[model samples]
Target: MSTIQFTFAVFLLMTCSSRVHSQICEAGWFGSKCQFQCHCTSPCHSITGQCQGKSTCLKGWFGNACQYRDLAHVSSCNIVLNPRQPFSSWVTDRNDSTCNEDVTLESVALSWSTSVPFTWMRLTLNESVILRSLRVSFTSKTSSNATCIDTKLYLINNKTVDIRCKVIVDTTSVIIEGQGVKSLCSLYINGGRNVALKQNSAQTSTYTSPTVAASASKAVDGNTLGLLSSNTCMRTQSSDTCPNWNVTFDQSQVLTAIHIYNTNDAFPVCSGRCGLQLNKFSLESFNSSGTVFRYQDHSTTFTSLYEVTVAEMASGIPVNGLRLGLNRTNPILMMCEVEAYGECVPGSWGLECKKICADRCSSQCHVETGSCPVCNDFDDRSSCHTGCATGYFGYDCSQPCSQNCQNRECNSTTGLCFSCVDGYLGPDCPENVTENIEDHLLILITGLGVGLGVSCAVIASLLIVIIYLIGRGKQPLKESKPSPDYIQRDSIGTGTMDSHGYQIYVTPVRPYQNVSNTYIKVIGDAEVIQPPDTYINVTTKANDEHDDC
Candidate 1:
C-alpha cells in the first residue's frame, strides 16, 4: 500500500472499534442491534439486557425490548379448522375472515298469511360468528306494532345460547350472548321491524357439493334420501358386483361415531329381494386428503338404521368422506342415510352439520344431530351471518301459508301444504272447484254404454223372431181326401209283384154277367172291348201299380 493510504486505513479501523465498544442498548430494549422489546415490569439488566423482574414480553411482544407488538394475535388459540383455506381454493372468504356485510333484515323472518293480521319477523345467521353488536331499524308505522325480537347463538365448539329483548322502537343496539365465541356459526332475530312485511317465509338451502353423484346415480334419484344411500335400494344391476357408495365432504373431521340408515319404506319388497336390507357391509372413512379408516358390520335384524362407534379413535382420525362396500350384493348394496360424527365441516352449523342452508332460506330449522358448536338451524351458506328465520318455507320464504290455515303456520319445507286448508290441495294449493264436468262426462259415458248394450239385446231378440216367422211361412202342410166315386165300382181285386217290387191289383170281368150296350166298356185307368156278347170273359190290367194295391 501507499504510505498515505495505509495511515488513513489504520485511523478508520481504530475509530470504528472504539464506537463499537461504547454503544449501549436503551432501557427495556436489548439485542446487538438494540431493536428487541422486553417484557419487563422494571428496567432490564445493563449488560445482558434481561428483564429484571417479570416475564419477558407481556402476552404479545417478544425479545428483550418492550416493543408493544401483539404476539397474542399471532399466537392466538384459533386453530384454523378449514382445510380448504388460504381462501384461494374456496368460494367464500378469499379476503380476510372478517366480512362486515350490511344486509336487509326484511327477508329472514318466518311469515305466513293469517285471517288475523299476525305480523312477525325473524332473522338467523348462517355460520357461528363472534358477535360484535346487533343493529335494529324500524319504520314509523312498524315500531309501534312489533312485539319483541329474539336472538340465538351457536358456538363453533358445539354450544347454544338464547337471548330475547322487547322491541323498544327505532334502531336499538343489542349484544347476543355477550362474549367472543369459538367460531360462532348462526344468529337469529324474531318479530318484524314493520307491519308492511306480510309474506310467506322462505326456506332456502345451498349445497357445497364435491362431485355428488346426482347424474351418475343408477336408480332411486339423488334427492333427500340419495345422500345417505348412494346405491339404488330397491333395484339391482344386471351384474351382481357389490355397488359401492361414496361421499366427499368440504373439509376434514376427527371422526368419533357413525350412523347408517338402510333403505326404509321405499320399495320394501324389492329392497328385501335386492338386498336393500343389509346383511354384511364394510365402511371406510377418509381424511381431507385420501387417507382412510376402515370398519366392518354384519347383522340380520332387518333394521332400517344402524349406529356404530368408531373402534380406532382415541383422539379420532381426520375424515372428510366415507366409502361403503358390500361382500355380496345379491340384490343391491343400499343405504338410506349415512351420518358421521366428527369435526364439523366449515360453512356448516348445528350438530353433524348435514343441513343445506343458504341466505335464500327465510327461516331455519333446528338440527337434531349434535350440540351446535357454531351455526344454528338452517344456516345460510351464501351469507355467513345471514339465513332464514325459523318456520319459514321456500327459497326466500316468498310463499306464505293460506290465510285460513291453523295458526297461519306451515311446514318450513312442505309449507302450508303439509296441513293445507279444507278445500285446497298441492304445495301451492290451487283451489278445488266443486262442480266438475269430468264427473258428469264419465257418468254420461257409462249411461251410453248401458243403453247400447240393452238396445243390442232387444234387436237380437226381434231378429230371431222374424227369422222364425219367415221360415215357417216357406213350408206347406199336407191333407188327404178320398175319391168318393171309386168306392162303388170294384167287385174284387188281387195283388201281383212287379219288377220294381211294387204291388199291382187285377180285376176279372165275367162275359155272362154283364154285356155293355155296345159290348164295350171303359174303366178308370183301362179300356175294355168284348165281341158281340158271345160268352166272352176278359181280364183287365191296371195301368199303374196303384190299381193292384
Candidate 2:
C-alpha cells in the first residue's frame, strides 16, 4: 500500500468510529437501538424507555414501560358543543349503547331545523386533548336515504375531517358542520362510560302485586325496554299522592344532563296513555345537604318524546342524588331507564376520572371544564395556580401584603403575614405587643432577690439545729478491741485537763483473763501532785503474771 492510501484509511476508520459512538435517538424514539416509539406525555429516556419530564405516560397509556394502552380511556370522551345553528341543544346529549340508529320511543334524537341547509356546531374543550373519532348518527328525511351528505369536522389548524374518521391531533376546539343534515338521532364522540350505571336507587313507593313488582333501581339497570310486561321499568304505587323516584350516586358526580326513558307500554288494554302519564313531572338534583335544584320543570309536555332530557345548571352542578317526581298533582310515574352523564367529582376530570385538577385551584374545579371556581390568585385568570407574588396576597392576588409583615411575605390564600416585624404580633401583624426592656430587667431582679431571701432563711434554720445539737453534749464513743502492744483511744474527747500536773492510770483488759497474756504498768513521779478524783496508779510484776489497778 502507498503512504497516502494508508493515511486515508486510518482517518476514515476514526471518522466512522466517532459517528457510530455518538448515535443519538430523536425525541419520540427510545430504547438502546432507538427502534421503539415513546408513548409518554413528554419524552422518554433513550435507554430505559421510561417517561421523562413529568414522568407521566400519555392518556390511555400506563405501566412502567408505557407499552400497555387502556383502550377504554383512549376511546372515551364527552362532547361540549356551542351550537351556531337554531337546532336544539339535545344534539350534545350523551347516549349509551342501548340507543340505536332508529328513533324509537326510548331513543332521544335532535332534529335539525330545515330552514338552514348548512349547520355548524363548535366544540369547546377545557384542555387540549387528542382527537380520536367523531360518531354522529344522522337520520334520513326519507325512508331510503341519508340526509347528512357533507359532514365535515374543522380542526383547530383548519384541517377538515369526515364523520367517524380516525384523527390523531392535539386540539382545544373544533367545528362540526354537515350539508343537508336533516336530523341527528344520536351523537357520540369516541365513547363514554355511563357513570350512573347500576347506582343505588329509591322511590317513594314501589308498585307491588301478586304477579310483579317494580322498584326504583330498574330505571338505572341499563335496559331501555319500555314495555310494562318486561318488568324492567320502574313504577311508583298508584296510591302514592306524589310519585317520586331517585338514584343516589355512590360518589359525588358533576352531571351536565340526564336522559330519562319513559315507559312506552304498547298494549291493547292501555290506550295510548301509558307514556303520557309521565308528563307533568319535574327532574331535580340534590346534594348531601338537602339543597335541591330543579333542572326540568313540570310544565314540560313531551307529546311525542319518549326520551326526555333534563339539562343541568350552568357550570355542571355537583350532586349526589337525582329525583324524578310528579309536580302539583298525583300522577303515575314510570321510567324504563335513566342515564346521568358527565364528569366525575371534583379534584378529577377527563374519562374515568384519571386527570387531576390543576394544583393552583384553591377550591374544587368544574368537573368537565377544569375551571376553578376559586383561584389561588388574581394575577393569572387563566390558571388557578401561580400564587401571589412576593408582596401580593388574597383572592386573585388583589390585596397587598401587610406592612407589618417582614419582607412583605404573607399567605396567598389567607392574605395573612407569615411572620411579623419586631413589635407586631398575630397572623396579620396588626396588634402591637412591644414592651419596655427596662421593665423586664426589673422583674428579673425582683425574682432573684426573692430567691436569695428564701435561701438565706433555709441556711439560718440549719445553723440553729446544729448549735442546739452541739450544746446537748457528746455521745459515748463506740469501743473496739486493740492489739496487746498498742493503746486504743476513744473517739469522744473532752478538751480539758485536770488541775494535777500529770496523771497516769492503768486498767486491766477485762476480755483477756488468761494469766499468760495479761499485763499492766503505770508510773507517776512522786513530785507531781495528783488529783485523787482524776488520777490512778497501778503496778504489775511481769514474772508474777498478775496485774491489778
Candidate 3:
C-alpha cells in the first residue's frame, strides 16, 4: 500500500471504464448507447447518426439527428415479384420482394461454344420503390474465373442503372446476368420511400354520418380498402358544389406519381363506388414558395387505382401540398386512398433525390435530370438557349412577324417590327401610306386639268369676238364722189391746189382712221398725180372740212 501502487491501480480502473462506455456498433447502427438504426442515402456518422458527405436522409425521415420519421416510407417486404419470362424454372416463390437468406441463381460457364449473349433472370415488381443503392452476394459452386458480375437496375421513373457489383439501384425491379460465375444470391437495399404517407390531409367538408369515420385523413392512411365495413375511404358532405381534398407534407417534395384508389364499396354498390364521379377531376400541386402547378384533366373510370404522373419538374419548386377535386359539382366525392411517391428533400434532384443542383440553376432544377430550366424565349424551345429566329417571336417562337416588316425581323419577346418595308407603318407594320399618297395625287391632277380647260375656252371666245368686230368696221364705204360743183382748183403761188387743176377728187376713209392725201386732175379721162413733196399721210376726215390750204 505505497503511493506508487495506489496511483497505478486508479489509472487501470479509469482505462477500463472509458473502454466500456464507448462500445462500437455495426455499420448501419449508431447512437450514444449504439441502439438507433440509420436509413441515410449515404453512410451515417457513428456518433450522431447523421447522413455523411452531401447525402440526405431517405424520404419519410428528416432533421439533423435523422430521428424524426414521417409516413412516406413504404416497405418492399410483402410486394409481389413476377419474372419477365414465364415457365422459367430459375424463378420461384423465393424470388419475392423480401430477399431470402439462401436464394441464388446458377449460370453456365463462359465459352465461345456456349450461347453468345447470356440470358438474364429479370424480375418485375408489382409495385415501384424509390432506390438508392443495392448489393447482391455472389458465389461459385464450380471453378469460375470471373471476378465481377454485371447487374442492371430498372426504375419505374423510366431510368436505368447498369453497373458491376454493389452500385446505384432503382425503383420497381432489378435484372441480373451472371458472367463466368455459377451463383448469385441475396439482395440488399440502402434507401428509398414514399413522402406523402400519413401526412396532414384535409377536405372541403367531411360527411355528416354517425356510423362512419369519413375524414380527409382517411384517404392517406396507407389503406386501399374501399368497403364501407373497412371505413378506410374518405366521403365528403353531399352538396351541389364540387368537393376538394388536399394533403400537405411536412417538407417540400419533388413528386413522380400520385395514385388515387377509387371507392369500390360492395354492400350498397352505387355509381360513386364504380368511379363514375371520379371522372373529370383535376390535380393541382402547391409549392412551398406559394406557386400552384396544375395538371391535365383525368376522365378515365377505373375499378381500382388511377395513377397521375406529374412529369414536368422544370419549374424547380418543391411541392408541399396537393389538391384533387372534380371538375363539375357532382354532389359528393368519395376516395378510398391516395399515395404520393417522391423525394422529400429540396435543392436536390435525380434518382433518390441524391444529386445536388448546380449553383447556376435558377429556382429549381429538373427532378430526373440536373439540368436547369431555361430558354423562356421563343428561339430555343429544345435547349437551344438562343433568341427567336427571324420572322418568329413571342413564347415558343410560335407567332410569325408581319410580312411587311423589313427583312422579316422583329423583337423576339414582342411581335413589334424593327422597321416597315416601303410604305408600311406602325409597330406591326400593318398600315400602308403609299396608297393614300397616290390617291391624293390623282385628285389634285384631275382638278388642275379641269381648271386649265375652262381658262382656254374663255380666252378663245374673247379673241373670236374681237376679230368679228374689226371685220365689220372695215367694210368698204358706199362709192360716192364729191359733187362736181364742190370741185374748185386755183393755180395760186400759195400752192393750195395742184398745178394742173381741171378737176379735183377726194376719197373718204372709214373705220381705221387713215386718209388718202393724193390730188389728181382729170381732163377728158386723163389723170394727174400729186408731186412727192405734196404727198402727206393724212389722219383726218374725208370731207372738205379736213382740208388745210
Candidate 4:
C-alpha cells in the first residue's frame, strides 16, 4: 500500500507538470512538453502553433497549425454544389435517400406543379454559396432501349429560363450563362442541415410496372455501378403540368447556378416510359411579383450536360422561389437530382460570395457579390472598413477632429491627433498666439527716423550746389588787347594753295563780339605769304571776350 501511494503521487505530479508546460510556452513554440520551437516569425497559438492576426501567416507555412509548407490554400467560402446537402422544394412528398443513385423513396414521392401546370418545384438551400460546377448524379438502371438520349434538361430562375444549350443542356448539368454570374443568385433558404428532396408528377402514364418502377429512383441515388442505373432509369409522369410551389426559407441563401440530373444515358425508348426524359421540355420559374416582366428566353438543343454557370451578372431581385415549365402537351418532365448554387451567406454575399463584405455594412449587401450596396453613416462606399473620410472621426464619422492634426489626418474613430501641424498643441490644438505690438511699434519708429535723416541730407546738398552756381554767374570775363605788331602780321592777305602741305583760305576771319567759336588751330609753324586774288580782314579780337573769327 505504501508503494502504491508513492507511485500515484508521482504520476499526479507528472501530469500537472505536463499541463503547466503546455500552457506556459509562448505563441511560436509547440511540443508535448512545450520545449520544441516553431520557425514561423508570427506568433502562433501556444498549443496549435498557428499564426494569427490581421497579417497573413509567415511564408512557407500555412493552415490553422502553420505546419504546412505547401502553397495550397483552402477557401473559407462554400463553393461546391451538392444536391444532398439538405435542399427543400415547394412540394416534396418524401425526402428519399437520394444522395447516391442506389437510394430510393420507399412510400412517398414529392410531387409538384400538377394542379397549377407549372412544372417547377420551389427550391431552397441550407447555406449561401456562390455556385461552382454542378455534377448531378443520375439514378442508375439497366435498359435495352436506346431512345433515352432524347430527353432535354434545363434551369429556370424566377420566371427566367436559360436555354443556351452550350451553357447547360441535356438531363445532367448546367453552368450559368454569360459566365459564372449573370444575375443575383443569392437565396435565403431554410436554416441548418437540408432534407432530401424529390419532385413527383401527376401524369397517369407513369410506368406502373415494377420492372419500370424498380429503377426509377436509381437516377438520383448515388450508385456505385455507374451507368448501369443511369442508362435505363427515369422519373416519368403522364402529363407535363404545373407544379405550383412557394418555397420559403428559414434563412437567406444565395443561388447562382442550377444542375439537373436525368437518365440520359438510358437505352430505353422515349415513349413516356421516362417522364423526366423527354424530347422537348422547358424548365421555368414563376415570378411572384409584377404583372409584366421579361426573363431569359434563349433556347438551344440539349446534349448531355446542361450547365448554366459562367457569367458575371446580377438578378434584379433576390429570388424567393422558382417555377418549371414544359411546352409540349402531355410531355414527360422527369428528373433524378437537382442542384442549386449561389452566394447568399449572411455575413457574405455575391455570385460565389468570393468578394468579402465591409465590416461596417448595416444590413443586406449586394446579393451577387460581397460588396456593400449600402453603408452606415460614416462607412465607406466600397467597404465599411473605415467609418468616415479623413479629418472626421468618432461614431458614424460624424464628429470633426482638429485641423492641426499631422497631415490634416486623424484616426477615423477617434479625434485625437497623433501630432499637430503647426502653431497649436494639446488634444484640442489651441493656437500659439501672443501680443507683440510694442516691439513692432519700436521698429516702425526707428525706420521713420532714418528715412527723415536721409531726406534732410539730400535737400542740403542740392541747395549748396544752387547757391554756388548763382554766385559764379555774377563774375565778368577779363580780356587783354592784342599788340600792334600782331595786328600788322594778321593784316597781310592770305593766299590759297593746292595739294602738297599748302593751306587754302576761303575768307579771312572778321571779328564780331559774342561770336560762336569755330576756329581750326594750325599744327607746327605758321608763316605769312601774300598771294593774289585772296581776301583778308584787318579787325582783331581777344579770345577772353566772346568773339567770332
Candidate 5:
C-alpha cells in the first residue's frame, strides 16, 4: 500500500475505535454505557454526530461522544408556553441564547399564576423521579393590606415547583382553615388554606345535650358514652330528670380525646355540616347539675371515627357542664367528626356548696382571727394598748366590758387601760389614798422637818444636863463678895473692911507677902485688926480685958 494510504488507514481505524468506545451502548446491549440511553429506536450521526429522525434523536448521545450524561439538562424539556399575562409570570435562571441551536438546551422558564395566593406549587416530572429543590422569582403585585409574601418549594410527582402566599399578620391569626391538605404531594389552594374571618367573641350558650341523647345513635359507636362521673346528682333538665348520657368536665378536660365516626361519605358544609349548628351538641355532668359548661357555635365536618380534644380546658376542678341538643335553626349536621373521649374530671357539688357558704360568711361577718386578751380591773396597757380603743374588747374589738371600771376604760383588743382606778394610786388600783401626790409629798416633808426638830431638842437637853452635872461634880466658884465679918489685910501697911462687919489692917513691908493698897473700914459691931512688921496683932477680950499691941 502507498504511504499516504497506510497513514489514512491507521487514522480511520483509530477514529472508528474511539467512536465505538464512546457509544452509550452497542447494538443489542443495555444498561449504563459511555452515555445514557434515550430510549431511541434509530441510528445516529457518525461524525459531529447528531440525530435527525425522532427515533434517532431519542437514541442519540450528546455529551463528549456520549461519555457523560447530565440530568440537569432534562429541565430543557420544560417549556412555558404562555409567558406574558397579568396573573402569571415566567422565570428562568439563564438567558435564552440557543433557541436555534440543536446541540444546546441551556435555559428553562417557570410558569406560574400570580393572582392565586398560594404558598407553594408543584410540578410532576416527565418520568417518575424525585426532585429535591427548585428556585423561584416573584412577579405579583403586592397587596396593600398584606404584610409579607413568602415562597415555598414542593415536590409533586417527583418534580420541583414553586409556591407563593401571604405571610400571617400575627401569630394569633388563623391560617389553614380546613383540615390540612391530604398530603405534601397535593397542590396548595391560593398558596395555602388560610382564610381570613372575623373571630367569634360572643359568650356561648349554656345549653347541653342530654347524656342519653349524646350517647344516642352515633354513626360510629353503639355503646353508651361515659366521660367523667361524680357521686353528686347530675344536672337535670326542666323535667327534673338527670340529663341522661350527658357529660360535663372541667376546663382541664377540654383537651381530652373524643372518638367519633360517620357512616356517610358526603362532606359536611356550613349549612348542612360545616355551619355553627353542630356547636349546639352539649356535654353534661351530674356533679355540676344545672350548671351548663359550654355551648358550641362552630361547625365541624369530620366523618371518620376520630378523636379530638378541646384546647380551652383548664387545669383545675372541673366546672364544665355537658348536654345534647340540636340547633336546627342553623340546620347543620353532617357526621364528619365526633368526639367520644375527653380528659375532664367530675366535680364535687357538695364541696362547691360549702365553698359558697364559706365565701358568703367571710364577706358578711368581716370577722378577723385571733381573740382579744382579757382586760384587767385596773388600767393595764399590755394587750390592747395599740390595737383596740378604750371600752371595747373582743375577738375584733366588737364587744364591750361587762363591769364598769372606776376611772379606767377598757381597750378594744385587751379590754385594759393604762390609768388606775379613781381614788387609787400606783400602777394598779391598790391603794385608795385621799391625799394627792403633792400633798403626800408635803406631809412627808413635814415629817422630815419634825424629826429634825426633835433631834435638835434632844441634843439641847443633853447639853444642859451635861453642863449641870459638870458644875456639881466640880467646886463652885468662890463668892464674889466676902461676908461683912471678914477682914482684909495688906503687906504694904494698908487695910480695908467690909461694909457689913469686917476689919482691915495695914503693916510695914513684909518679904514674899501679898498686900492690898486700899481698904474700907466700918465702925459697926465688927472686930478690929492691927498691922505688925513681922506680925499683926489684934485681940478681943471680955469686958474687963483690953487689947495690947
Candidate 6:
C-alpha cells in the first residue's frame, strides 16, 4: 500500500484514458474503451468520413468513403443487327428498376427459314441485382421468299418463382414456370415481347408486347435465294407468283458489285453462268481527281461469284462484265445465297461515281426522242424558263413595272428592272413622258385656237345687232299738241304764295314729294308777265289793279 501500489494504479488509469481518447477520435474505432471495431450508425460510416443515414448512398457516389461512381450517369447501350451474322447469346438483363444502367442485345444475322424457328437465348440476372431498362435489335432475314417466324423469350428469378414465366410469341399471355431458387427477374424481347415477375405470390405475372411490330414476311423463294434490291436500279417487271423481283440498272449508272443471299442453301453461287445481266446496261465513272468516263449501252457479264468476295461490289469499278447467278430462274430456291460483283469504269471512284452521271443526264432516256436530256432553254417561249422578268412579274411578264428599271427591259429571270407598258410609253409608264410631250403641246394649241375663233364670231354677231337697231330707230306717226294757256301742276307742296293780292296756298304734304316743280306768273292792269321764278316756283299770283287796292 505504499509507492509500488500507487504507481500501478496510475499506469492503469493512463491506459484507460488513452483508449477512450482513441475511440472518440478514430472513425473506424468504437466502444467505451475503443476495444472493438464499431459499426456505423445512420449517415455515419466507418469507410466514408461523412454519413447521413443508415445504408443510403448519395447521387454520383456509392459504397464507403463516398467514392464517385457512374451509377447515376445517363448511358445508352445500342445493339445493331448485322445482316451478315446471326447471334444466339443472352443479349441483356437490365429490366430491374434497381439496375439503372441500359443493356442491349442484337442479332446480326437474319434467319431465312421459318421452318427452323430461331431460339433466343435466355437472359438471367442475379436476384440481388437491379436493372433499369433493356433494348434489343432484331432484324428480319425475310426477302421475297421466306417467311418470318415468331420467337419466345423467358425470364427466371430465384427469389420470386411464382411470378417467373415464359413470354409467349403473342405477348398477351404468360405461363408461370414456378419460383425455384432465384427471385426478382425480368425479361425483354426485341421485336417480340416483355415479361416481368411480381414480388407477391398471390399476384399474377404480367406480359407486355414489343413496342414495334415485327415484319411478317418470308426471306427467300422456293429456291431459297434472297434477292438484293439495288437502291439506284429501276424495276422493269415484277411477277407476283415468282419470289424474285427483276430490277434493271441504268445504262448510265456505274456498275459496282451486287449482294445476293441464298437463305435456303448455305452454299455459294459463284461458279455458274448466273450473275447480273449487263445487257444494254450503261454507266459513267468518276476518278479520285473528279474525271468522268461515260459509256453508252456497254454490256458486261460476271463469271465468278462467291459469298466472302461479294463485298467488292462497293469498291472501285470497271464493272462491265460482272454477273453471278444460278442456271435456273430461282437460284436461291433451296438455300439463301449472295452474289455481288461489279467494277467502275476507268476513272470512277467513291460516292461521287453515280452522282457525276446523274448530274449530266438522268437514268431514263427521253421518250420518242431517245436523246440525252439537257437543261430547258431560258427564253420566254419555253415554259421551263417562263419566269418573272427583271422588272415585270406574273406569268407573261405583264405587270405594272417597278421604278428601278424604268424604260428598260427587265431581265425575265430576275424581275429586277422597270419596263414600260406598250400603249403608255414612259420611263415607268406615265412618270416620264418626254417622247409624247410635243404631241400633247400640239393638242393644247389646237384646242386654244378653236376657243379663240368661237369667241370672235360671237363678238361680231353682237356688233351687227347694235348697228341694225341704230338704223331702225325713229319711224313715228302724226301726234296731237297740248293747249299752251292752261296751266298744269303735276304736284302740290305745303307752301303759300301771295303776289299782287292774288294768293295761292296748300297744306303740308303728308308724304314728302319725291320730285316737285313750281311755276309763278304775275298779271297787273292790262299786262300779264312771267315771274322771276318762272322756271318752277312754290307760288303763283295773278296781278289785278282792283284786287290790289
TM-score to true structure, per model: 0.24, 0.35, 0.35, 0.28, 0.17, 0.18
Off by over 4 Å in 2: 1-193, 209-211, 266-272, 295-313, 328-330, 350-549
The 0-to-1 C-alpha lDDT of every candidate, in the order given, reads: 0.36, 0.48, 0.49, 0.34, 0.28, 0.27
Tell me the tens digit of each residue's lDDT in model 3 across 1-549: 999999999999999988777767667766554545576887798767778887666654543345433211223222222222223322222233332222242221111211111111222322322111122232232212222232222222212221222111112333233311112221222222355656789988887466788889888766777754577888776662758889987667755556788876643334435456666666677764443455545455554667555533322236787887754544467788887755534367643345787775532454345554333233543343677778886445656778988899876554567777888777677777677667766766665565555556655655675576567885433343423432221112123323334223333211121111111100012122222221122222222321220
lDDT of 2 at 144: 22
RMSD (CA, Å), candidate 5 to true, equals: 58.9
Worst 10 residues of 2 by lDDT: 515-524
lDDT, candidate 4, residue 153? 19
* Candidates, ranked, TM-score: 3, 2, 4, 1, 6, 5
lDDT of 5 at 271: 30
- In model 2, the clashing pairs are 360-384, 360-385, 377-396, 378-396, 378-397
Per-residue lDDT tens digits of candidate 5, residues 1-549?
999999999999999998676665444222223111222345444332333364332211122122111111232222232222232112221111211221122222332221222222333223322111122233334322232232222222232232322222111111111111111121212211000001111111222354323212222222223221211111122332222233232232212223333332222323333323334343322123333223333335432333232222221223343334333333323232233322112221110112111322222110111111222122232332345455655333445543334444543323333454555543223454555555666766665565555556656655675577567875443433433332221111122222322222223222222111111100012122221212111112211211110
Off by over 4 Å in 6: 1-245, 250-432, 474-549
* Per-residue alpha-carbon lDDT of candidate 2 for residues 70-136, written as tens digits (9 for 90 to 100): 2223223223333333333344322211222222222222332221111222233322211221223
Residues 1-549, candidate 4: write the lDDT tens digits. 699999999999999988776676654465443432353566656665555574444443332343322211112112222223243231121122212221221111111111101111112222221122111121112211112111111122222111111111111211111112222222111111111122222232334454456234333332223232333333444442431111232233333444454444443555423433433433332223421111232333434444333121222123333333344445454554433433344465432233455675533343332334322224554444556677776334555667777776655533556666655555544543222334445666665565555556656655675576567884332233435653443332122223322332233222212211111100112122222221122112112221210
Query: Candidate 3 at residue 463, lDDT?
Result: 62
The top-ranked prediction according to TM-score is 3
Which stretches of model 4 miss by more than 4 angstroms?
1-234, 238-255, 271-279, 287-302, 309-320, 343-362, 365-549
Q: Residue-wise lDDT of candidate 6 within 308-409, one digit each (tens)?
A: 221112222222222121122322221122222221232322111232223222322221112222211122421234455344542234443455344655
Q: What is the lDDT, from 0 to 100, of the residue 302 in candidate 2?
A: 43
Question: Candidate 2: what lDDT?
Answer: 0.48
Worst 10 residues of 1 by lDDT: 194-203
lDDT of each residue in 1-549, candidate 1, tens digit only: 999999999999999998786567666544444433345556775445566664443433322133322211222212222122332111111112343232322111111121111111112333432123222222222232232233323332212233222222222222112112223333222221110011111111111225322221222121225332343222233244545566555444444455665655444435433334466676666553443556656566566556554442222234556666555534355554455544333233332244544443223322222222222223343233544354454333434555644455654433433444554444344544233335555666665565555556656655675576568884432232323432221111122223323332233221122212121110012122211212111112212221221
Clashes of each: 44, 5, 3, 88, 57, 89
Global Cα lDDT for candidate 6: 0.27
